[model samples]
Target: MSPHPALSEEERARIDYLVPMDHPFDFRPAPEVPRYPETVRRNALSNHPLLRREAARHHQLPPDLVARLAADDDLGVRGLLAQNHPDTPAPHLLRSFLEYTGPERSHLTSRPNFPTEGAGRLRRPRGP
Candidate 1:
């Protein structure tokens, strides 16, 4: 049996409001959300619609949630934290690109995660 009830068309449309076309919503709540006694957390944050979106916003994020996301097992979740974290190491940010292959990595790379002093080099050349 599926863990979550089937999402209605309305819910699916609502999700569309949050993410653009071509973004996949084939995700479900991770078992950890319910605290299954025997299972260790895996991709818990990544599967959550709320968590990933909130991480993307990078605004008014609480430290506890950020820490949880940073330590999340899923590379996507960790990548989001790295992108949003105010102090992600440059080495770590670059490494995430190699380790996690997906739109999430692309999104993070577009942000300001490079080495503090090296970020300028990564930016596009100013228009003439």
Candidate 2:
């Protein structure tokens, strides 16, 4: 059986509302930087491991939830944590990315938000 149960359409849609389809990185515009569905905010179970893992991608997921997700075993979620964790939330996991030897490490290097010290290339020029 799949370790993470398949998400239903509605569930996927809810996830999308926070992390848009093409934008992909749990992104926000930096000042308002992260936001999520009201249900996610209000639901007590929002901190459940799966929710924590999914919400970690949003620039806006609360620090507490990010902590919970980091504590989970899902490497993909940690990859999201590496790319997303704006406001400098998870320092250790960010360091761990360099130690990880998987494709997910790309999250740290490729995302525009990665710290300049860790990023390989200069800021990308605008493209059309």
Candidate 3:
């Protein structure tokens, strides 16, 4: 037998507040104070997905950090980079478009660098 069979409503609400599935994008303005390069780099490498997502949302991230977040395994991190970061590479945007099925996925297709051409090559032929 388990000690706790299910989460209480309050616990569920708290979890949802911490990580809302419907609203994946964090639009709150980042701090105006300049962050040190090392701090930015550390955030990029943090094990916590929320921290990585924040790093991806920063407007002035170096190209290397943008690339690092674009390649992060977490879908939220990569999606945020593709949606918010101006310097995000086109390949990363394409990968995010293919992988992320969130509500904002349609918005990704409208990004300036998202690859609209060559998608036909990704389709597999039906087996006879």
Index of the highest-TM-score prediction: 3
N/CA/C clash count, model 3: 0
- The positional error of residue 102 in candidate 2, measured at the CA in angstroms, is 3.9
Candidate 1 global TM-score = 0.38
Residue by residue across 38-87, what tens digits does model 1's lDDT show? 12122233454443544533533455665566555555555655655565
Model 1 collision count = 0
Error of 3 at 98 (Å): 1.0
Report clash pairs, candidate 2: 26-57, 34-60
Q: List runs of model 3 lying over 4 Å from the truth.
A: 1-23, 26-38, 119-128
lDDT of 2 at 70: 59
Report clash pairs, candidate 3: none
Candidates, ranked, TM-score: 3, 2, 1
lDDT of each: 0.48, 0.49, 0.70
> What digit string (tens of lDDT, one per residue) describes model 3 on residues 32-100?
886676766766876556667767877778888887888787788888888877667889988987887
Using TM-score as the yardstick, the better of models 1 and 2 is: 2
Predicted candidate 2 versus true structure: per-residue lDDT over 1-128, tens digit per residue: 11133554346445523322222333234445334455444331342344544565566656666666556565545555666666434354555455455544555554544456644443357899
User: Of the pair 1 and 3, which is ahead by lDDT?
Assistant: 3
Clashes of each: 0, 2, 0
- How far in Å is the alpha carbon of 59 misplaced in model 2? 1.0
Looking at model 1, the pairs that clash are none
